[model samples]
Target: MDDWVDPGETLETASFERLYRGALELASSVERTRAATLVLLTGRLGLTLEEALHCNEGWVDWERAELQVPEKDPCACAGCWELARRRREHTDPIREVLYEECWSPSPDRAPRTVPFGWSRRISAALLATADRYLLDLLPGDARELLRAAGEAADGIEPDDLTPGLLAATTVDFLSDLGLEADGTAAVLGVGEARVEPYAAAGESDVTTRMARLAGVDGSADPESAFPVACGTEAFESEPFDVGAADADALAERATATDAPERVPRPTDLPASVDYDPADHAAAGGPNRRTDAGSWAEGPSAADGNENALRADGASAVTGADRGRAGLPDDPSTASGSQATAPDVTCARDVVTQPVVADFSTRAAADGLCGGREIPGRVILGQEELFVLWSEEKGAEDADAPHLLVPLEDVWDVRIDDVPGRLSASFPHAVTVGHRPSGRDELAVSIQLPPAQRRDMASALYRILLNVTPMTVVDPAREGGRVTDADPEEMVLYVRPHGVAFTDEAGDAARLAFDLSDVVDVERIERSFDGESRPAVQLRRVTDNRPVTTVVTAADDRLRRLVWRYVRREYHQTLATVRGIRLSDAEKMVMVALYSTDGTPDLGSLLDLTEQELSAALQSLAAKELVRSAEAATDLTGTGQLAVSDRLESVNH
Candidate 1:
């Protein structure tokens, strides 16, 4: 069954069926090409609204029955360039650096070929949709179509309709007509085929399949396969048999019976626990407690308790508290407090020791020197590596002139022997290769002190390995023929946008997979030369082929680390594709809740007004990403995933 539904409202099965039928009828009234385009792209092919817009007729291979989606090149148009230029004008160097380097405008669209075969009706509709030129339907047109469909189904608001919602409904409608395995398998080509009782049919056998789907078998009633109108005599008279019945038949039976006991409505259910707003306010909002003695002590005593509560609930222990308790807050500090509050460690607390170095920059385009070396203190931060050149050492000022390099952009970092003209104290040179604007690589070089040289080098190596290129051999192709052995030795590079395998010199890419395309990543033990060794396995789909590759590193630790990085990258990338962008206030509230135990006084902590906090919470709750009950607000599973994605970007 299709899991996706319209976010604005949850429709009952009967209402959804009515809506589906109405939509199909409404679609039939539109221009044949437009109607076909709407139904085929979203319903059969399962392309998202954005993907459907970018699609061209030429992408479809008639002979292979496949649609080949090409990678999108970064836009060089005047409008796009203007936007990019304006984005780079931020006053904060760190923000500017992140926007330029770490952040990507869109998720990676690696070239993908999806094999698809549909019933004759769908095939004819698609052919008509793509007459001579590529289907050039606009977003407004798609919206209008969905709006009309909504209106036809008992006046659902046009504003509540979204492309994703409509597409999901269409898929569900088709699935009811017995195309579940075929349609779902074709859409999800990365996995094994789903088993069904009916033999999978080809285009020629589509007519028979359609007939079977419609319940046209000798003894079955044709109308039995579809949903019946609610409260109708025909619906009540018809006997429902659960055996061998599809979803529509079940829905029809359920709707006809008006079984409130079977399908309880949210509005009809009574509250599990009575909550009094008056009592809540008298207690001084959600975060404040009202124990018998505390409440009797009045507002003054309540204030002190609130402060104490804040101290206990706050994830990070302050310097004042550390001194008063005579216990260090650092987890590494040999103390029992670490065990008691294991989650106290925040991302900001994990800062690397600063190393004195000389920094220089070179233009990526021309490979020419952009600046001369300047003495500075280099610090490896949670988010980025920065160099502060101010004479006042040990001072960390945001406004000071500094060079910031986002960690996500640092693809490669290697230590080299320092040459002449540099300080003798800084004897080692560390070179970083990164793409600031998703263009050519910019090289940032720093000469590190001899004492902390290895420490800094190892730190960079460990943290940046996700983006660094590593030599890997494809075990499957190791003993294959010479012609098929080209991929035996390749360099694998995992970036925020995508994963790619290139030649030894990293000049030409042999294979590349979008983070979205990677369906699975696993760590497994592989036997080589009668010895067991750890390896990472990646599985992706390409041109109807489920490609699996096992990658091994020089040691078990490195391989395990690679697996972790790959999995993390995959999750983060998937989260971005959800099309959910939280506002600044929403983010602050989410992070505060994620980092702290119980609910903090969000209004005070985030400096948000009561109205603003309420609005943000409502929006989050509507999206099903957050859950709140009375005084406590917590993240739903989806909310946790979203927050984790955001935290990874900051903590990396």
Candidate 2:
């Protein structure tokens, strides 16, 4: 039985709780130095001061981090040290800890050793597994971490002693590789970390403050979040600057340069912004030039304003010698002559690019591993189709959209319907799962799109309108050929169509059913004797629709029975597949482990204490069946060897 506190135990009692409580109470009532006295007595001596103050004092260690005590020595320092000198003594050596160390399973057992080449291979394996499982679902950071773990596992030696360092290193590696974007990190199961790019161009002071505010000293739930702080700081330091030196001066200068308009003035300004075509041949001419049409909502050709900006500063200089062209070299206009300049311009039209249509096609079909098909129909559950079809190059002007067709309309099924895609299946079928009492419909494996999800109940209601009922058929007595000359010989014929038969009287018959309608047919035969050359004889019945045949031999019958048992229970022959069933093994292991406390090395299963057995079992994991229930706790205070011994016993 486990130990419980005694009723008579008090401050003077030798029980652990009593001494510990007395020390705590005594220390609290006295000064700090006096508290030290209580600590020394209870922690180092493991006894009350009254019980341990009289023991020897040579076991104390003032330099090293430990206290050495002889196996049989009853060392005590309470009486040896005077009260005044205790405070100045070196740090105490014997530290007493009360809590148990909770042991979690170690991923590996051997000491660390660097395996550079092997680590790479391991990383490649991990990457391949991740790729195969569709787990590239994490944010960039997490994805990077997974990738890093793979790399590190490949490159590192076995002797690395960093504690929880591997996990962190992987996180950092992912961030460095820019794999932390989107949602990669979380999907990859990598731990969190902070990543900052453009740090050089970024404001260091602001980032530091933000980082500090979110660090250890920061409030767990502050009034403001970290991102908010960064945003607020940016806003306060750099508000919009429309009046800055860059473009504001140009706008201001342009205002002063314009001449006042006259009531009876020409539709265009005498000297307005405009392009001159002659300037096109000149060096360093206008980088861009446009006519009235350039302005999206500008005057049209019918408007007089279209050609009125010939002298405007916006016009390009066609030639440096403008005076020879009868135009004022400076801003002054020529006397009564139109100041003309060649228009150097180009027209640019903005067009919209249509979105390219794309989609994938998946069918609701049988899974290759295990499932069933009903008559004239097949039931598929969470089945996935992965087709590799390349998208057609988009025509420059077409608006074509892609579509997905499920089941390809059942009536159109053909031998080559799913070329290169063959499926082998088991017999379980899908059905509506459990639901809340008031819930009237089942949810689909894939959630409905937003439009449909909004009214899932209604969508499901419409779906249930056309669901067909399943049909069942028996195969025995369907069709078989019987020989008239030999009453014991019966031949059964099975075809893609319903089973057919021929009686001993030379009569042929066929069942009126679809080939898909039949599931299984059993030929029941009775075996009597334990041994015989033929082993059994057929007992025939003429009036049993088609015919009936029974065999005789106990051994033959027993062998057949076992075959049927396997078909009914497992639904498949064990020797035919490669897989493991862990449920039965789990039950057996638990029984053995719990009953016998395992020993060190776990070599001996017959003799084990409860603690040893518990530890042994806790160190290992059950590997066979898929566990559907809660797991049992492990034993403590026992070493690995003891646990291993117990495990071997339980397993054996």
Candidate 3:
């Protein structure tokens, strides 16, 4: 049983209540040194101060920045809300946590090394202050000393670790990286330091703060968060440079320095940003919105406004849902009424079941690897997707599978097929992932039966294909950056049509080629540490050129998936052409046309052919690979349109 006390349970006890009351007093010390006492006790008690203080407050949890307090639930007991440090991960097989599935399967094992990486824990301490009760405790029941102290447990909060040193370190770190220290300081808006750390701190914490300082933060929330803080000491020390604070001066300086406008003026909106029904129809698809509203808002408009100042609310709004798209999540809406007991009818009857698809049934995923929860199958719970294991060998053991990918967290997928598995899959696995801002994309593979692999590939492709476009720009710029730079010189971003790269700052240049144009992709290998680290290389339609671009973190799966998608039409065309029985001469003509720009030497094809030249011309044209320009045909737009659309039309 867990030793941590639940305030709701123990608060009624008079002795325990008195001890908790004392902890509260010591924890929030006006005399900073007393706060140190609370910190010390947290270590001794083996709980983070936040976890400790939360152990009290009716076991209230002031979760992260918005301070969400989840209502108590059946599983919100001391075991899951552990008071002890994590020597081993909690699991469903043992610890009854918040939800059966929320239980992590990984175990705490010492790192594999010649000498064990960790072991041997022992502790001793010298105390300066003691009470009569403390004197008795030294030689008294060992349980009392190790047993969680009620007074200490009821009131510990995480140390917002004085932000002074952290803040200075951040500024100095940026300066050392060749950034102008004063310019960076001015951008942060303090007199070199102090007075409210990263204003973004209210909405974010340490991880978010570091991302912003390094100019790499993305709009997506961090996987976890911890608080950051600072006090008023630097503000009290000195005051300087009051004039740079003037809004008009800042604006004037921005204009004089040729900085880009933070938002497009309504008058400056690109024509492409406006909706057009005709173009959508021509693409063989209907517009997603028929309300005559714009369908082409700038790519980042949907997700990039979280850090925007409240004063800039007008600019932050998107064309959809009247700017509601950019709003931060509201914590107040999360009070989902206390988790409650269910009536008998609330549970699904297990006696009878309806038919399920063969592919979706557990039997389909069940393979030589035992059970429904296999290494390749997705584990669903908490409305998310995760693969149970990364590798299958000995995966029956919970601790062996070190990787678990929450499926919905995946943003992009690229499959690379390996020889051996049917039609082309190595062990029939594909990797799916998301690219974070300018960072490399992360991919994890899930093995599948060949029958299921095709279905999974299509579903994953459609999922990533539909995500609204994203553009990555330098995060440190006061105003955002949008560019028209060439793909070779820009940071890569995904769009519905293809990936884009911007070579210049602001609205200078953007190079986005259609996905259809990508001809091939290859993996670039690196082995600096005797382990393979590879990047992706993409080639456009012209195969002779060196690979067009290399995307970091793009694994074998991405390389394969891109080529698979890009060559579907090419393969289809070849399949259709191969159906016809074309002689060597006719086949040679088409091959030459495909290879050299659009013109082919049918003269060589017709000059030494066993068949008549007229017959050869008719034969090639029948396959739609080539057509006769001199044939008797209507002088209508059809001829001109055909020439523009087809590869080439040669004269007889």
Candidate 4:
């Protein structure tokens, strides 16, 4: 509590996002902030949470051997001096801002500060790397998409721009890809000279592309090398929309699959044979023959009618009709003459293989879940869909999932609208939840631009259908992250019912939670295969002094099994004690106390009214998750009974 004041008190805490913006505003100078931020963000000189909160130009001298904090008072009791906490605050919001955007985690123990927002001063190289990461996350042939965009954009480097700019530029490039030199110039608002360079540079092959990625110079000849591995024709990244032609294509594919019948292609000739060239010539001379004989005997009345019919037929053969026939509207005007099919990949599979196949009817695992996927991965292997999502911290990392969930276990996927918006620009969110374990439920939110929601959802649906569990659960295996082991030894593997481990005797042991004594699950970092797999550490209610045993992350799944078991047990214990879901007010109060080092006076800190506080306390008391009245009743001055015996595990 030494010289700390909560910034939330003076500055409004209505929207937590503001806290991040405010930090950058108070960062003193933009350039200093950008540079120090990059260092802190990149985890080069790893600073702890305490250090990051108090960091300033004076605080962190990365070049110095010893990390130093000058003797001067860092907080002015309301002064501008950088301080850990002008008031007690939780670091989650701040951490969320930095890591999700620019900060890359380091394998080492030293903590680092991460900011959520950005300014243009951020180096171009860093922006490129970040954009690459985003593109990597998108499902599909990312390389092909990149190459196609580069070709369309002429010579602009794909990685030269930030993610936002890259996305916009890609849309333009793909749309203008087949345009003629003149059309491309018109679309790009540039001269034909610029279009030539883009077109000339467009044909780089895959080998040269890889060379470029490796920092090699000179473009690869398109004929010499192949385009990106996705087979260069390219898949447009835009979400799908259905059209009549697409519907017919789907039907054709279906018919072929069912009966392998050959389908006929439409004729190159006009559909209507009503046109008479002689009549057309007499009417408008459009049907005039090249022969000298035709000139000698001018078109007769019948010839005039034929000429008019030809004109009418030509009109019907262009525009919409041409599109339906998959032909150019005007053969001479169509650019490049290298046009491939309109990128129909998204729309092709969308309608037939929708997330929920036959939504008007029921199908097994047929429902679609569309939302912003959480950070965790869905490893879809041969036989299973192992779903994992988490913030990968203490308890969260432990309960993460790894093994297969039976196909039938996945059910109850429901989509609900989340009303309201933080700003005019931000779209209203929609939440999607699915029960992958039959018993356990997980949910995610989609907050994309309104126009892009359906497309994103379609992409997500395809991914969900394809995902598999990281590894099949096998008891004989050395690594099985979730262990429901026997009671005596250390838990090294997570079982369906308990955890397994090696004891002090160097013998295998197992332990199942009574669902009472376990306090919290903390992920302890350990190295494996030159990579670090976070191991789980348990905190118990029995003895605070003794250190607990670690449950290792075994197998291919990243700490999912251990994380899931620990968290599920923790929640089950609370549910047993509380008997129902905690209200928003109750959860907030618990979080507030937890954030403030488990102290009383939570209502004032959270800016909750007395009535709200009373109701929340009542719920906490009924659930037996907290002693609301105990702190108020305390005769000697001390913090309130902030959390219950079971709930205390969550706080840790």
Candidate 5:
């Protein structure tokens, strides 16, 4: 029964609370390397992989072009620059430098370059490192928890912040890691200012207050306009005193419910017993008698004996009132005041009931709801509900409407627990719908900002998986081994996976290896199966033509055929446009345009760079058709060609 209860319930209801916290810290070292690589590729080489991969070596003929590629140079191609190997060299040490520099007060004294370019790369790397660190700090059952969180945070804007999310993530991380409660709480409180702004904006005062109760430091600088629609803390803190007292007084004030009168009136006080004024004078001195006579002179005072009783009772009542005035107001006092005045906003549930309750009850009655009887409401046509909820759930961990409800009420919930769903941020995608199909039910979805999602997932998944790329050389592979060896005759080359490298020497006919032949297995404490990309190979058959036969190593043709099918499905296009490794495509397009001209060809088109034209001409000459000559033409030849074209058009 205890295990069956929701963890949140246990956390809130139990006398003691325990949260799992992560020991790992978040950083962006891994991301920095990728960014750096992209920068170098685009900035230095002027190439975009999106377009350059379209031209293969054969497609880039260089006979008439000036770009040179020595046949014997193995390291002289654009695709074989060894970016991952280079990245490893650039990152590991630099990350340590950055970490130390950040910790140091004197940043200027830091031992490395901190340029804008460096910062971008570093930020990217830090983001990646932080994700892995977070995963290590989460629990094994973190998936369910994170999914619930994401669902809770659905529809939230990336910029919206809330303290509920911060506390939730903190508590969840601590609980997942099985950390010491005190230590977890302390850590949760640490950096509250930094985390709170990213998590607490746009939330209700109650929810924000609750977050503060949990030690969240920051407050919404500018409070939200629709605070009621905010998260639980505010909803939970809905005052039940004088404002809500109206509901109880509903029967007393109006002939509403059948309940008995609950509101107390001042007139309901007991009447004082009649007494003689002579008794006050006889018991006390002249001072007491004089005070009694003064009171007796008032209009409310009755005849002699009654006036004496009223004066004595008034003195007694005033003394009691003085004692009460000294005592602080408690719940009872608060209730007493409401009982007399019955202020609707004072905690009276007078006219309006909790909107959530109405929604829940209506939904349950219509089979549209299931959850604890929380007294709150979701206004119809309120678009900000999701944003408010996400702010509560923390940007990353928040899910959609379903997570806020009891898990039992929901038939099915879908979540993506994996990292990188939103680019290294574990922004889990969540959706809830009735049955397998239901038109009557409401379905909502959201893409959590990449950073927030990653943070949440890391907080949930306690297991950290490291991704380190390595370059390996295999002797038996066709594209030649990645070894410290001399250049040899090879038809194709293979580039390292997930890294961008440009050939240094710029050689055509350079041997490039396939994505296969080299394994990029993740070393996850040797506990998990490593993931790999689809493999491919390039080969030239006996027919004197290049045919890329994606064959199996075991000589199993049928299995190879099946693999081809799978690969085709995975890769989709076999036109070889996706895998080419080059710097610029405009050069190729320019050369192709020039190829249409005859005779000196007026040189190549103006748009092409020397590199693309050179590479292409080399490939064309290899095919033995296109030729080039240095036929320097004067201005007269250019003019004559322009005039000749115009005359030809007129004659037509």
Candidate 6:
């Protein structure tokens, strides 16, 4: 065979149009059926050589204006058998790991139905040439005819002529004429057709030929005609202007490369405000002495006659102590002054203040690390929850050691009201379950003040709602009437990762199911007390054992709700390909696979080469629409949904 020109390579629009018109005109030299086959193969119908060859008269539906491509039995060729053997070998290890049966022994192919309209040109061609076996119309001289056609148009030999090349050329021509895939399909009386990736640009001589033939202006705007080629040049040619003063400033800044000796002060800093002693006292400063007498009035006051010196602002106070207390120097006690001195408060004096909780108490001591009984205050920050604790009691120190837990690490939370008998001061108990980095699951319990319990719970709940992907459904709010069979009231939460059944209050999680483990969901009826109640049954596979859960409700709508949401989640999780744009070949393969039953031999059925089919399958797998090509070749739940949505659009 001669070296075949790659159909995916770029072709000039003018050349493509010339070759296409030449092929149609040269159809007269061949048999009637052979000529019709060539036209059909090169048109917007997107047919493969094998499919066009296999087509028969029975495929057409005149009344419905439709065409049906009947399914073919599995090919027993040596190539197919070798391909199957390689697949089985590759999937054997995977089957062992999953411990489940994967592939079916034999699969059946499903026929595809496409919309077709009756037009004068197409009707006449089909009526004159269509037969029981269309391939019979083509003789061994077909290659000679293709060579003659190519030479007449672009001086190319028969080696360059192929079904893919012809189809790609025709699709590109139609696209340049302002007809999209759907529009082209309508005009040609075929299913969906799309322009190939490499044929997107209409810059070549082929485009000029096509323009002349179609009566379109060939000298239209270059940017619109060739966006990929002219985009950067157009952008670079745009004018930009700068003012003289701005340019001078920019140049000055660029030239000043020398390092300054000292950093310049920011001009935007605010001026200092005068200090007020009364305001400082109200803000918990050292000046206002309470019933607790100041050390200046103690017995040491006389020894510090010494006290007289301190009163006169002559006492030696260390700068470190003032800094530790976050205090400013007293203006009244300046040097050479006789004003009364304010009492000084040291770090030790500040440490003696009482805290909100008594850390030494037995109840508070039980919540720390393995009963080590350290004293601490639990502080909930915006992103993390932490406990600040110190060995010394009665101290609220910011420098104390603490344990930080990011809110995301917390997976479960339990809140309960502490009985009065346990501890009257600490009335609310909150336990948080978390798994920290490289650590096993652990629980931390804390007692909250009576007044702060509601606020703390509300904040934690808000954080959980924002971070966790969950949809809470209240049975009562959704008009569900609970039956006696399920006496315990429960709430249903549908989540992307899983589902959970909680108590009616939505606080306690009673049961949970991961989405992956769920195999099926259906509606069933359960009898209790001589009455049948509608119920939804969830079937899951866990630990190689089947487990079933049936939730009963008085009304059938409740069952429907559960079934609908579960199915919807399954479809959504598997069908991530939805709403995503696919390539032309990928879309066609997806539709073909969806229209089939079981794991049919798509390569043979669609008449696709092994490489072409493999490429399409790999692309679909990357988008998560199917398993890898080496695995069972079938459309996943997501793939099916994607094809269904496409068909729905076509129908509309």
Order the numbered candidates by lDDT, best leading.
Answer: 1, 6, 4, 3, 5, 2
Q: Give RMSD to native, each candidate.
A: 31.7, 37.1, 31.3, 31.2, 40.4, 34.6
TM-score of each candidate structure, all chains considered together: 0.24, 0.15, 0.26, 0.20, 0.15, 0.22
Q: Give the CA lDDT, 0 to 100, for residue 142 in model 6.
A: 52
Query: What is the Cα root-mean-square deviation between model 1 and the actual structure?
Result: 31.7
Q: Pick the candidate with the highest TM-score.
A: 3
Query: Could you arrange the candidates by TM-score from highest to lowest?
Result: 3, 1, 6, 4, 2, 5
Q: Put down candidate 6 lDDT per residue, 145-173, tens digits, no spaces.
A: 55565666655555667765655554554
Considering summed lDDT, which 10 consecutive residues are worst modelled in model 5?
Answer: 284-293
The lDDT, on a scale of 0 to 1, for candidate 4 is: 0.29
* Candidate 6 Cα misplacement greater than 4 A, ranges: 1-17, 20-33, 73-119, 131-144, 154-156, 177-652
| Deviation from truth (RMSD, Å), model 6 | 34.6
Q: Which candidate comes out best when scored by lDDT?
A: 1
lDDT of 3 by residue, 1-652 (tens): 1232321222222332233233334322221122322322232122233222222111111110011112221222233323112333543322222222121111211111010000000000001111101111111221222232342444422121222222333333233233343333432223423322322212112222323332222332222221110111111111212212222232232233232111111122234334221221111111111011111122211223221212211212112111122333433321111112311121111111110111111111112233222323232211122333323211333332223333334555433222111111112244455433444555444443332343445444432222222222221112123323222323233333344443322122344454544444455563323555564444443221212544432344334444444344334333334334556555445444444434334455335554565565566566443544543211111112222233343221
Candidate 2 versus the native: TM-score?
A: 0.15
Q: List clash counts for every candidate, in order.
A: 0, 58, 13, 59, 95, 9
Q: Per-residue lDDT of 105-175 in model 2, one digit per residue for the tens?
A: 12221111111111111112212221122121112322232233223333332233122222233223223
lDDT for model 2, on a 0 to 1 scale? 0.22
- Model 5 whole-model lDDT (C-alpha atoms): 0.22
Over the stretch 227-247, how does candidate 5's per-residue lDDT look in tens digits?
Answer: 211111212211112122211
Compared with the true structure, all predictions reach lDDT values of 0.43, 0.22, 0.28, 0.29, 0.22, 0.40
Give the residue spans of candidate 3 off by over 4 A. 1-359, 362-404, 408-455, 462-520, 525-535, 542-582, 594-596, 608-652
